[model samples]
Target: MSQSDADAIDEGVLADARAEASVAPVPKGSLWRDRNFLTMWSGQALSQFGAQITELAIPVLAVLLLDATEFEVGVLTAANVAAFLLIGLPAGAWIDRMRKRHVMIWADGVRALALATLPLLWWAGALQMWHVFAVALVMGIATVFFDVSYQSIIPSLVRPGQIAEANGKLQSTYELANIAGPGLGGWLIGVLTAPFAILATVGTYLASLVALMLTRDHEERRAPEDHAPILREIGEGLRFVFTERLLRRIVGYTATGNFFNTLATTLLPIFLLRDLGLSPASMGLIFSLGAIGGFVGAIATPHIVRRIGEARAIPISAIAMSVGAALLPVAALVPALAFPLLVAQSFTASFTVLLYNITQVTFRQRITPPRLLGRMNASVRFVVWGVMPLAALLSGALGTWFGVVPTLWIAAGGELLACLFVVLAPFWTMRELPDAHSASR
Candidate 1:
């Protein structure tokens, strides 16, 4: 149960993943040609797009239908991710004990049922702000487990060298979901109701569940063990993340980025709908421009890292986020160019985000051993994603006190300051990731 003792046990468990990888290597053909990869990709893509629907629809629902205040919108946003802060640590610990694929399947099913409540309540004329908040809370819990398991499962499916390409292909979903999901959700909210738009999301989860059910996983099911205590296991993961030289700095840097990123995400829709006088469909349209930027970014990641290196790529994106956020307030001061400025802001920020995400996620997977992936990912998510709710709450309060524009400006400053994290951290000295073989050694 002690740290050294747990590490000794973990060494043996991790060999199972590497052996599985060697026995069932990723296809020599294109990843798309790999049947299991394709099935998994389809499910992930569907589920991601479904989740994207809520990002636009639920926020719009609160603002447009409920006439929620800035603080209330923040609360709504916070409610969705609060589970990450509340249960993230334990969930990560628990998931490491199970077959990740099974966890992912169950996660999708539970999520679908939880999301169905909003529309059902609305149709009966019984929907309240609390109902929406509650559903988001439940959905968040499901997402936390799914994402933890999902990230852990990826390393087992492919050779270590292929992690970048695999992550690149997976990230393509962000672009698709961002562009299509919001655009459709906005239009659906225009033609139908926001509640009805969410119904499509439920279907996507079902589709994902089915796809995952059929896909064959390479990692052998974990054999029964004299399991370590939960707290000890959790501590080991945290230690691995924080004490590992490369991972610790990345975690710290991203934690700051997540906090600042929340400010931009929490405020942008409010700014668009309230002050700029844009409709939900129009806002979604502008948002898609960002996704287009993201699409380009995903495709460009390999080339960018090859050209400039991950160290620069990470900070470059962080600095770009700061700059992108600052421009929105400047654009708003001019009446004629606000729409175009908003589009520009979203596009630039999104593009940089993809650069950071693809590079860092690939790096994380490559550096981490297969056995510790769940706990390591959870530790990172808990530190990085855990900041979202707190940031949202602060953004909401700032908006309530000083109004949306000033609040945005304040957030912009916070984001810009966060860029200092990468400059000061140990990552700037590092260039390439270590080999996966090094992990076992």
Candidate 2:
């Protein structure tokens, strides 16, 4: 087929897919009514909860057990994000060529096996900083594969009208896991030590593996084509995301928000523990409040999106995030307000992030070709997520020079600045879904 013919065919397929997505009536009762979606959702939820346990445990292990300095802890955090920068596009390309379900299953299995080794090494007295670093990098690589494939699979499983609802459900599950996992992890670390506490995460990944295996679905077939070089494929994905006007704006705005958020994430634990002299249990309590906020936001997002429209949702949520980000400095100044500060931060951040995610993801899914979904998702994440490590490093360096409190003020200021991106962009005026249907006509 000629290029124009191929474009026409793609447009036709998208039209049919969008119409089906827009009007497919989902049953109102049990989520399990769609057994495949439920299975996939449940598996991912379980795995996310498990991942959170380790997310807390790893830093705790580094901070409390190994006596890592602020900079070292930041490096450890950066290590976690490094794989997304390095392997993200390639992983996405590979995912586009294979069965997403199988990719998810293998990814889960890899994370489970990687996590399980931590306990083994701890028992053998062979665990070290490098060991933790290695595990973090591997786990990150596995996550890249799982995440890229998972996002691509959702559109195939649900109708278009259901995308926001499905995404809200998924976010709710993740938020619930966040609420439960860290609180539970703090208690586990208090009782069992960080290494042993991480064993729980291993079990969680195993549960996900089993659930994914039980999920029944026909494998999606790929279009026949010659494979391009990995570098060229990666470049194509990057170009598509950057060249597309909507995606470019979203990426720019999201990347701005994420950079500051990541800076805070790298600093928060150190700030709470080192400067404020808060215990792990207390820190966990405060963090759990944020999770509660996330849960509320996630559950409410679909309705909120429907009510206000996706475009308006972005700036509203962005303002909330800005307010939340600015509140971090208050927690530092008035230690008595730490809990309340955390609550505000959690609530606003969760609400804003959910709105941003639902809008951007739905738009991207609508615009990108199905065959390119994995790479496109990964490539965008590569840019958005890739900055995290650099942010961590910058935060750590700033903390080292100015102390944690000053560093946090700077980070919060940076986050507040993110609002400018949205305020200035055309996204501020976009109050509804684009004229996607017109493309078909």
- Each prediction's whole-model lDDT (CA): 0.75, 0.72
**Every model's TM-score:** 0.83, 0.83
lDDT string, candidate 2, 123-212, tens digits:
888878888888888888898788767766666676565655566577567667768877877888888888888887798888888988
Instruction: Kindly provide the TM-score of model 1 when superposed on the true structure, using C-alpha atoms.
Output: 0.83
Off by over 4 Å in 2: 1-42, 153-171, 220-233, 298-312, 363-375, 427-430, 436-441
TM-score, predicted candidate 2 vs. hidden true structure: 0.83
> Which regions of candidate 1 deviate over 4 angstroms?
1-43, 153-170, 213-221, 244-246, 362-371, 426-441
Task: Name every residue pair that clashes in candidate 1.
Answer: none
Model 1 residue 239 CA deviation (Å) reads: 2.3
